[model samples]
Target: MKTGKKVVILLEAVLAVLVLAAVVLMLQGKNGQDMVKVSVIIQNSDDTQWAAFKYGLKMAAEDQGIEVYIANTGETLTVEEEKSLIEWEISNGADAVIVRPVPEEGAEEMLKKFEKRIPVMLVGSTASKDRSLSALPVTESDNYAMGTALAEELLKDYNNSVEGKTIGIVSETGELESVMNREKGFRDRLLNTGIQILWSVTNRSGEPKENLPADQPEVNFVAALDNNSLTAAGEEAAANNLHGAIVYGIGHSTEAVYYLDTGNVKCLVVPDEFNIGYQSLTEISESLRRFFHKVQDKAVSHTVLRRETLFTKENQEIIFTMSQ
Candidate 1:
């Protein structure tokens, strides 16, 4: 009888231990059930311009043991489209979301609605038209400073004799806060240089080349503020369509680097997109691990590359992130 009683006691103890384990897992929540999942949304998610940025995201995701999904999106997205995409991400089991916001009307309301449901991290640029909207954390470069650097390089090339140099400006949608800041920075640097800005245009329809008409007026230089604009200007310059304007601009793609290598572009300012990816995910992962952790804004740095310095050991590291 005592032996039978002992067997019953052992069974009960094992059952109790299993029950406690279940309770602990339940208390741990979804995090205990599976790995943390994150989704990313950006404009033209497959574009070559995002090569380095995506590479950074991959490295960070591996390091943090987090699952990341880069949503396929078109070249442009309306605020409504962004809302839908973000909602899909949350509904499909995303513990966190990172997005390059669509700069448009009604963006603030949309972001607020979803931010309450999950942690929303902003990348590339802010979604608000106000430009001062900062309720969420952002990871990007000092666009204004990048612009200043580009102008400084231009000034250096001309031996500070750029007082009367006529210039044309080109960029992606002029509405983006990043793009606007860069233009502002570049213009501010030349505010006292007596340089003439002949024309400035944007590609609202995703076609950078449209800004460069065959009969475009001649300018001493062309300042492109994004990869698309820089590449378009470089191609046009190579074909003698930019009226022999020397190309100086900010870029982040293999094609842009190629242009600089072949002497089609004068100077290239490359923002630290890899760090932007790594740091954004790193912050997001940390927040997931700790409930009250606040991720601060990070303004990544940039590097100025000339053709002669493109193959240096340090620059090659940047290129590997961008191309490989």
Candidate 2:
């Protein structure tokens, strides 16, 4: 009788431990579920670049276990509006928030404030001061590199013909960092070639009389260098003396592509936005997983993504069919 009672007690203890273990596993599953929620905020979700990035994020999230949400401020958003959108995401329990900033100065401070509570990742560009606010950054391309590459491609085909030719850069605005960088690179490259940059004008702001003096050499090419500024510049170019100048539209904006096909613009430097998005997620997902598992100190942060593909008439068919 005593032996039988001892055996029964042992069996009960084993069953009790098993029940406790099962309960612990259930709680752990719930905790893991909470970690899966991720939100990405952008200036505009419909923009081609952001769309491509979202595609990558979607694909990556599908392969890995994640609940991904994308929020944007629509087609046109001010800095304050975008900031409010991000704050709302954070307040609603977003484990991670990724953003493509509208105004770096104001946005950075807002993002930094949220970072104390949750991980805030910045995708493109940077604030003037580089404090450690971003959990990760994946950028596509910048203006300076695109401008230099555009000039190089032009130079390659032109051989010796472009050496003395003058180029014009038509922009709509001058405040964006990407725009300024491209302009600087374009000027530096052209002037270095001993060629002339005949005129550079903004859309909202017209050309200065002294800058486009009558004695200056004619602009052989006018590079419509931005998506937002292209239409206005195209109109301005048509009205001005550069009606038939070769036009290079930078960035793969829908209007830019249309202009290229209509013969209003010559070519475009398309940034690989999909790749930037995919790589960003692929890299960050693993890092995030590792951080959660305690295998790493923190998520792998700060990746600069490339965003330039030279598009031309010869490659028109390929570019046209691309979804994102």
For each candidate, give its TM-score against the true structure.
Answer: 0.89, 0.67
lDDT of each: 0.85, 0.57
Clashes, model 2:
5
For candidate 1, list the clashing residue pairs, or say none: none
Looking at model 2, report the run of 10 residues with the lowest lDDT sum.
296-305
Q: Positional deviation of 253 in candidate 1, in angstroms? A: 0.3
Provide the global lDDT of candidate 2 against the true structure. 0.57
**Candidate 1: stretches off by over 4 Å:** 1-29, 129-131, 205-209, 213-215
Best by TM-score: 1
How many angstroms is residue 204 displaced in model 2 relative to the true structure, after the best TM-score fit? 8.7
Model 2 off-target regions past 4 Å? 1-30, 129-136, 201-218, 230-242, 292-324
Q: Summarize candidate 1's per-residue lDDT along 137-194 as a digit string, tens digits.
A: 7898888899999999999997878878899898877887889889999999998788
Instruction: Estimate the TM-score for candidate 2.
Output: 0.67
